[model samples]
Structure formats: C-alpha cells, structure tokens
Target: MITEDSEFLKGVKEDDNSSFKAIYEKYSRDLFVYAYNIIKEKTVCEDIIQEVFISLWAKRKTTTITSLKPYLFQAVKFQIFNHFRNNKFSREDLTRLNIIDVSMNVSQKLEYSELDQIIRDHVAKLPKRCRHIFVLSRYHHKSNKEIADELEISVQAVKNQISKALAFLRNNLQLEEVAFISLILLQ
Candidate 1:
C-alpha cells in the first residue's frame, strides 16, 4: 500500500491545490510553534511559515520531498537562522535561539539555559581586543577584512584574534557546547 506521505507527495507533484492546502494545514502550526520557540515573535514566525509554504508551492513541480515533516522543519530552521543573521541579533539573542529545542523536556531546557549562560559568560571573559574581534566577526557579521579595517589592524591580526578567542572559549566549554556555539557563530 502507498503510504500517506507518498500519497501527499504524489498530489503535490501533480500540482493539486487541495493537496497543497492539506500539507499547509497539517504542517504550518507545528512549524510556527517550532519557529516561535526560537524567534519569539508571532508576526515574524507567521511570515516565515508563509514563505516556506510559498516556496514549497513554487518548487513543487521540480522538487521531491521524501519526508515532508523533516523537510518543513529544516526549512523553517534555516529561515529562522537567516532571520537572526540578517537582523544582526545580539549574542544573547543567538544564545536564546541556539539552545532552544521545542521537543526538549523541561530538564533539557534548563540544561540548555545553563549551557547558554556558560557560553555567554566565557565569551565575556575574553580579553578586550579578542572579544571585540570575536563580536565583530560573529555578532555584527563583519568580514575579517572589514573588522581589520575598522580596527586599523591587518586581516591576519583579526583572524588571529578570532582564533584566539575561539580557542579560549573551547578551553572552557564542553565539546558539544563549543559546537553549538560555533554553529551560531558560523551561521
């Protein structure tokens, strides 16, 4: 027997409007909840969900989504990350966004919050120059060249300072925490 997901995919591939509407009705609320946990803004979350569905419809003829739920969730995650990155959110905002998992239990959320605080505290402990370079690169989304030019330093100096800052942070945080922080910084 063909699975429900396959049935949906077939309908979507055939450009059926009702199928598209069905997909949206099924996934939009969960996607919105997932996004809101990170973005904490109703309007922006709604817009992101709308964009995802719009893109889905636009790509339906060409795209093949084997698993709709994961695909939708991943799209929402990327959109939320882009929103955070484009808006130049602060480290605190990044921290809040990074550690949130809507599927997590209460204890997990508390653990994530503690880890977030640890990362923030360690970042605060970096030397002034290192912290400046790190913040310029990560929080402000500045290129190494831009940061160097603004600081009146060589690009290599900026790179070195960022490296040093990351090294310092790595020394204090666990491997998983470091990875999580790196994901936020790099993205």
Candidate 2:
C-alpha cells in the first residue's frame, strides 16, 4: 500500500517543493509545540523547528524514511539535546527553565522508541511460534510457565522459542550490550 508517509517521502525525493511545504505545514506546529514544551522559549523553539525542516530537506535525497512522523520527532529531540549540550548553561539556568530533566527524559524516550521499533520489526520476521512466544514473554510480560501453559507447550519449549527469538534479534540488530540490556530492562 502507498501510505501517506510514502507519498510524502516520494514527493520529497523527487524535489517537489509543494510536498515539502505540505509536510512543513502538517508537522511544524506539533514540532514547535513539542520543542517549546521542552525549551520553554518560543524563539528558540521556532529556530529549532526551522533548522529541522532545513536539515530534512537537505537530506531528503539521501535519507530513506519508512515513517516520517517518528523521524521528525526524533530530529527535533536531537536538536534540543544538542542545544543543551553545546550551550554552556549553568545548573541554575537549566533548572530555572526546567529543561535538564525533561531533556534527559526525551533522550531516553527517543532511544526506547527507536529500539522498540527495531525489536517489533525483527519480531515480525520471526517464525510463527517463535514470534508468539517472544511477544508473550516481552510484550505481555508472561513467564515461561505461563506461556507454556497457555500454549499447551513445555517450559523447555518456551525457553527454546524465546532463545531462538533472541538469537535472531541479536544477530539482526547487532545492538551494543548496554543498549540491548536497556531494551530488555525497559520491557
């Protein structure tokens, strides 16, 4: 199916200015609102959003985006984080704007969301039984005993299924140990 996001991306790749404008009109307000919430500065938020759009346009020819919404949101978040990291703001200044903790939270959220998408995509490619067992264990927070009982399988079978799933994901994702551990902890 040719989704709206795919159409927009196609237009962008073809250098359609109107398509870019449509994207800006559709997402700018939400992005601004999100940025303003974190930065608490209208001018700074506006600048960040503008820069995000400019960067998106500049990279349109090279970037392959399956989903534009999350990509844009993540870009805004990275820009915000960069603003905090690059500027020599004092603790008091950061605290005064209530930005320090919020920025950290946004950073974690971006990581988690990206990892979650990767995990979901890999899970979808798993074998049917392995996918079911993995989803039950990770998404439903079910124990091996519970999943085995529900599926009329042995706990050893459940363990094997989960192991297979993890092996596939680990091989495909090639995630760092810390990142993979954090993902498991989050689930």
Candidate 3:
C-alpha cells in the first residue's frame, strides 16, 4: 500500500487540492509543534506552517523533492531561525531567556516575539536588489551560480551581492545575524 505522505506528495505534485488537504491533515500538527518549539508563538507557528505549505505548492514543479518529511522539517527550522533573526533578538534577551530551550517563562517568550517583529521590520527596509538576493539565498537556498543564472548575472556578481548584503547586515545587526546569513549563503 502507498503510504499517506507519499500519496499526498504525489497528489500535491499533480496540484490536487484534496491531496494538499491530506498533506496538511497529516503533517500540520507535527509541523506546527516543531515550529512552536522554535518560535514559541501560537499565531506565528500557524503562519509558518501555512507559509511552508504555500511555498511547497508554489515550488512543486521545480522543487525535486524526494522526502516530504525532511523537506518540511528543514523548512520549519529555517522559518523559525528566520523569525528569530529578522526580529534581531538581543543577545542579552536570548541569554536571559535561554531560547535554545523552549521551556522558558511566559514573559521571556513574549519578549522573543517582540524582538522578532523588530528584526522583520528592519529587514523589510533593505534595498530591492539586496532584499531579493538575501531572500533568494536565505529562503530558497539558491547557490551563487543558480542565482546568477536565474538573474542573468555573473557568478562573481552573485557572490559580491551576497557579500555586500551580509556585510550590511553584520554592520547593522547582531552576531546571530552572521550565523543564519552565512548558513544560507554558504549552504
């Protein structure tokens, strides 16, 4: 018998709504819980799961996904980290709250949420090309060559854009910014 995830994935590949529903029914809770562990916001967790599924559907044609579970998990991890980074959560707050462990006090959790909003606010202000390059590299995990080819630019140009964006963020944001930006670019 075909497994549910594989079947739903097959249906999703064919752009079937029922199959998409099945996918949501099967993974939504688990994915949301995982996201909540990272983001610690019930509302944001729902949004993240929705965004992840929407992204999966949008990229279905070109995504070459073999395993849905791992891909979904990867998406959640990135989204959560992005939530944290975009918020520019202060190091002192991060340390005080022990965000690495989700078993924190409620007040600390609220603080984390506020910080995430701030980070998102600043990231939204980035220049057009810089923002696109950052999003493509960070969110879509595109390589320099792939980004260059897609944008009709030289690989060196792609590299320069990434370097410039990273430098800008590093200068303006905290050290945590370096980790995710590097993780996205170097991956």
Clashing pairs in 1: none
Question: 65, model 3: CA deviation in Å?
Answer: 1.4
Q: Given candidate 2, what's the lDDT at residue 142?
A: 62
Which lDDT tens digits does candidate 2 get at residues 1-187? 8887788889999999988998999889978976786678899999999999999999999999887877787687678767877878775444333222224477776765666676677789999989998988765546689899999999999999888887787678753422432223221
Most accurate candidate by TM-score: 1
Give the Cα error of residue 178 in candidate 1, in Å: 4.1
* Candidate 1 ranges with C-alpha deviation above 4 Å: 99-187
For each candidate in turn, the TM-score is: 0.55, 0.51, 0.49
How does each model score on lDDT? 0.76, 0.74, 0.68
- 91-167 in candidate 3: lDDT tens per residue? 66453232332334798567556655545555567788877877777656555777899999988888787788766
The lDDT leader among the candidates is: 1
lDDT tens digits, residue span 1-187, model 1: 8777678878988988888888888778877876786677999999999999999988988888876876787678778767865687665665545534434589987776787788778889999999988987765546688899999999999989898987787678776675444233432
Worst 10 residues of 1 by lDDT: 178-187
Better of 1 and 2 by lDDT: 1
Error of 1 at 183 (Å): 8.8
TM-score result, candidate 2: 0.51
Query: Where's the lowest-lDDT run of ten residues in candidate 2?
Result: 178-187
TM-score of 1: 0.55
